[model samples]
Target: MTVEYRPIVPKIKRFKILVIKIVFIVLGRAFQSASQHDEEIKREISSWRDGFTLIMKVMPDGPYMGLEKKNNMLEFKGSKLKQADLEIYFRNVESAFMIMTPQMGSHQAFAEKRMSIKGDLGIATAFTRALVIVMSVLYPEFIVKRLVKRVPPLTIKRAGLRVWLYTLGIVLGR
Candidate 1:
């Protein structure tokens, strides 16, 4: 008797896709809410096209998630749009989870070769900066400091306001 080969690729792919979608949806909500309340973040993203899209994938050719900025509003969805201005690829699911979950800072991940970027480098850099700012809004100062290379100066009042707004956005499903 001979054993038949079984393929686990499809199940693995589906799992990766689900993770990517969940990560991006949370990020999209945070970014959109931050932009609405933070002048600096709004200014940073204003230069981007109204319908600019960014895709992040776990591998060069793998399940991906997309973030679309339209009419100054940001939305995240799974696997839409044929092209994007920027595409960030993490070496694997573990690498993606590390950065997305704040287990490692994005800058560290880039330096360690866990992540790679395609498309315009400038656009990617700007987007990364915006993400850092959004993180500051979403997390406490101590946590944000650990996640970013250099935390921007923030007054206690401003930080408190940001945290409140971010929480409100999440509560209201903004």
Candidate 2:
């Protein structure tokens, strides 16, 4: 009996995982920056107790990103994979990518059965709002229009925030 040769699936998955990992790295930094700078994000997190942790990870496998609230600002826990107060689990890499990119939003992903949550719904809601605020600042107007239900007004301040994200947030992770 000849065994089936299935080399492609593993390679493809590894590639998808890598792409997702990079996206998560940038995402962690963006979240941290927004928490520190955006007034909306600050207000959103104000209710959360210090040390609040959230993790976003793909299901049935490895690779995860953790974010925690400390000193009233969000911090990226790059090497962390611990139990969080709110954990957002993606059924697969495609689902995570779609949600992470402007291709789709978190609400759509959940409704489509591509995502799941384990923890407090209120925290998740607040986190989603914070993420929406961050994404709007990071992406351009065209992409943001599609990523969010309502596009934030194009202003000099928003443009500057995007600039800071590129030069400092994504780069130095500040």
Candidate 3:
């Protein structure tokens, strides 16, 4: 008798999951290490706060305010910020992230509800916009690219489709 080798999708999935787990662990550790050196980030951000006011709906447990400057001063709530010479807002991190992400155009999610803002809308918009810009610069794109490159051969399209299907299934209780 002889045995035949077989390719199994389940095995492939398990392997993919393992790979993703390893990637996340490595990235998480890297972040933890980098955070220990955050004084540099603090200095960089402090230099940017030359002329700006920022209000944040800080998580009860989070550091309450962030003032940063790039080409101009910016105030960040969570990561939300205003960019004009003088800008302010009372916003939370969720709102900031939502406004800055591509979701701003239409898919505005949870930000408005989760955060409260009482200030100049124009300046607030500037703050969020500037925060987006500074964050883009501060976040290491190279790490992101490398992490993405490590993803299983599954393309983003496939991943997105899988997520959509999974979501649908959960919603439909299938």
Candidate 4:
């Protein structure tokens, strides 16, 4: 007796579903880890004990959010904090993450008005310096191209350059 083999469409469907589930789980874990990292940074900053409220209103729109770390507890508006004393402002979500990264200064996004820095100008400067320290300590971007390559895709690299040129022109009183 000969046994007949059947084509397995159902099996293929099941395999696709399994793959989708696995992908979702992996991505979810990555996002959670990133958020936890943000939280850890916030906690570390709070340790500084500034005792001043940093109200960061995401501009060109009225998000109206604030970061206040009076004591050990770090509180934010809407209870949507995964981090501490640092308040991020960006034109969009992608730019926000990019600015958070080290070697970020080369990117046009930071130089442009797209990402604005508000509150505690001294602390903001300190934060960037501290980031440099942390980056140097943890993972140094010694390789030039490797660091520059990580810059996010801005709509126009020329935009930042133009702003720089215009600023220089004004300073020179042209």
Candidate 5:
């Protein structure tokens, strides 16, 4: 009897790539929209290496999102860049989703060994803080509280600004 053998790894890789692309698209929109209206976000993004790329990936050769900060703007491209200043790797797709969905905070994911980061510590920390700020602008207060290690106090003005930024983000198809 003859039997057919098929590898599932390729299919899994494709799925992971699709998920990562979708996530990055949403994140890219959020960053671009927030930067336009929030000086703090613009400043934070500008601190990075000009044209520097940050890639977030699911490890074991999974999918990745390549993000570049240039001209004080954050943009996401479909494919991985040749080089990245920072690479944040999740052990697997589930691990990536756990943190991305706000079910587990990023700090908790790192503490639990679900993530591996390669880059300068200082730059990574600053980038993380910038992500937190971006999250605050993208998501609701309760969601942000769950996703971040520490939720900063939000003033009325800042909250109102977030609302406007979010509206702009949606309008811009972010």
Candidate 6:
């Protein structure tokens, strides 16, 4: 009797990429909404110079999404530009998927080396704060508390902002 063996091959799932793309769309849209309605986000972005761009993508051939501050507002860039002032890369689709699912926060992802940042450290810190603020408002209090170190109190404004996000901001892809 003769036995033949083949090699085990790893495949990147299309569904995973699709899900990530969808999540990026929603998250990008949410950022735009947050800039408009959330004071914290406005404060953070307002400090950035006009035309500043931030890009987030999976490494080694993956989908990308971006945002740019233009005219004191953030607009989705749809990954058209090849470069950005700040670039965040998830090591792989799996890593991107994990973060997109928000299994852990971006801070943990960076610590684990699953994510890398290319840009000014100070701006990155400010962006982190803005991200925390966005996550606090975008997710429910229970979920937000579990995901991040500090969950800002769910004030009436944040609650209303959340409602607007779900209803118009995210839904309409603003």
lDDT measured at residue 145 in model 4 versus the true structure, 0 to 100: 33
Tens-digit lDDT string for candidate 4 (1-174): 999999866223344334433422322222222222334344446545645444333333423334444444323333243333455466643343343332344235456765667556666654444333223223334632343434222224334422432444223311
Per-prediction TM-score to the true structure, in the order listed: 0.77, 0.88, 0.30, 0.35, 0.78, 0.91
Ranking by TM-score: 6, 2, 5, 1, 4, 3
Which candidate comes out best when scored by lDDT? 6
lDDT of 3 by residue, 87-109 (tens): 23324444434433322311122
Tens digits of lDDT, candidate 6, 66-124: 99998776888777867899998999999999988877788888899999999987888
Candidate closer to the true structure by lDDT (higher is better), 3 or 4: 4
What is the number of residue pairs that collide in model 5? 0
Global lDDT scores for all candidate models: 0.74, 0.81, 0.35, 0.39, 0.72, 0.85
The number of residue pairs in model 3 that clash at the backbone is 7
After superposing candidate 6 on the true structure, give the runs of residues whose Cα lies further than 4 Å from its correct spot: 1-9
Clashes of 1: 0
lDDT of 1 by residue, 68-163 (tens): 787786666447755677888899877887787777888999999998998888888888888888777666778888889888767675586476
lDDT for 6 in candidate 1 is 94
The order by descending lDDT is 6, 2, 1, 5, 4, 3
Top candidate on TM-score is: 6
List pairs with backbone clashes in candidate 6. Answer: none
Model 1 misplacement above 4 A: 1-21, 60-63, 156-161, 164-166, 171-173
lDDT of 2 by residue, 87-146 (tens): 999998888777765588776777888888999998898888888778888887777777
The alpha-carbon deviation from the true structure for residue 77 of candidate 5, after best TM-score superposition, in angstroms, is 2.5
